[model samples]
Target: MGQGQPRRHHQVPQFYLRGFADDSDRVKVVRFGEQPRTFVTSVKNVAVEANFYKVDWLDAVREDLAEKLIGKVEDAAVEPLRLLAQHGELTVQQRGDVATWVVLQYLRGRGKRVDSVGLQKLMLRADLALGGKQRLASRLGLDDSAEVDALWDSIVVRGELADPPTMRYSHLRTMFSSTISKVAAAYVQAHWQVVTFQRRRLFTSDQPVCLWRAPDDDPGVGLLTADAVSIPLNHTTGLVIFPQIPSGITGESAPTTQYHRWFLAHTWMSAEELLILHPDDELPDWLPAYREARLGTLGLPDIQQFIDIGEAWRTHQDRSQPAAEVSF
Candidate 1:
């Protein structure tokens, strides 16, 4: 809030973005949507939002606490990331630092913030529904019956709340503290492979940390359940992570095959693709698959269909069996 304080907070760190940048510190941004277009811009100008990490309730002096903390994490990981990108090797401590940074990058994004808020709202709604109006009002500190009735109508009947809950920077910090260790531990334990491509280049988006699940995996996916996690270290290099030595897979080449499969299931939002960073060279190989995957239509069979078929078969079997009733 002070003069010269940073108002624009980048969700994706500029230091990481610089890897995808050209020699002039510019990046080619491919905006995807109904009207997809490409343009060149400075890395600093993209993947940023005004007051993104600002804690509005905090005092001016400490308003940027989240930004400062994130900066420290980024600083610690910068060299480790650089080392991995360049030489594909890191000390144990350095690997830990990079893993922490990657986890933070995945969690501290606008999309994740939205998800947090939505989950909070869903929990609140469930609580209100389970607890009657009077109980909900009492819990919320509403003394008047009229206020309680109004609140119930607004939230339960209309599906709208006057004051929606939000996930502030402080809450985000709390989330980082609680979950960072677990998530980063998974990253550290996983087998990390640094991939350098001469025939192809990688691009990144505002939500750059790609958590990928296999086509046949369960629909519920997260860092823990992910088949692989990938992030583009630079246009020419990337880091891919997989579970430590899965069955039937051995040696160095397995990661590459897994990476390609992971790529086939990855999806991204068009709005979040505002600042896709790509190399200045020719279009990369498998561009079509990448584009199709981005649109979330890789032509793969839907997992839900199999689940539905199993459910239907179970229903048929239940109907065929003699029913028993219990009287209490």
Candidate 2:
């Protein structure tokens, strides 16, 4: 609305499974004197996710990142979204190819009537052999790439794309480069305190936080607060969203599982105003216009309608006996 005001987008929180390596006991602490090399691949992943929300690090934070890394914070701001989106799309295409191969092979292996669901599961296997792919193709009587693509899309559109068929840690590690590591280390130096179980606690933030959670955590949930946020951790990376130390809970005094810490973190984090950023430049030429046109269109349902629908659905369900029904 103002000359220098930022554009705003309503944030809709979508959950994904946490991405983290299970081993937490072996985390190496990067002390202030440790030789800092490029950890770019790791930082790139964090940056890309942040980019989707259009968040820019504060100036001081950017400088700290630069001192620790090889590139500018600006590059981190833009590149992750562009690169990761490309990676996801390409990986999906490759998976489609693999799925086709497997389907053709499966056809030849069995004389039974084809099950679409089973075929879908076969495509999901880590190593579907060339022979299997061919057998499936022969059995299904399909020689078309379009059919494969269609089948892939049918499954992917249902959120299968969230968990890609082929995810290689090495392939992703290559993206971060050493520079990103330096930035992360620098951030750790300033804000994090080492705790038991090789975890770190974050105490302050000049701006909104950049959080990553472990895979064990629920993907759909984040701890939101005025000064903190919990993000899903990237797999095979050191980046994570540390819950703040609670009022009476020190790192050593905290519960054995640290589940209570996370619980408190979630309580505080969820209370904050969610910032969802969208920049016009991030979209293709036609998309911005399309998005604008969709706003205020007739088919759109507001929050009240959603609540009404939920109420109607509940009412339709068989209720043996009801004392009271609370509405959201």
Measured by lDDT, the strongest candidate is: 1
Candidate topping TM-score: 1
lDDT of 2 by residue, 46-150 (tens): 212211222234453332231222122322323332322223222333322322221221121111111222333334431122223333356557788677555
Q: Per-residue lDDT tens digits of candidate 1, residues 1-328? A: 7888888999888899889888888887766556676788898888789988887754678878788888989999999989888764577678779888988887787666665555555556655664566667888899899989888777754558533435665347654685888877767767877666665555677766777676673565677777777777887677777754333221233335555434422423322555455547433344431332132211333333433555566668779998798799
lDDT of 1: 0.67
Candidate 1: minimum summed lDDT over ten consecutive residues — where?
289-298
Candidate 1 deviant stretches above 4 angstroms: 33-36, 132-154, 162-166, 215-217, 244-271, 279-328
State candidate 2's TM-score: 0.19
- TM-score per prediction, in order, is 0.72, 0.19
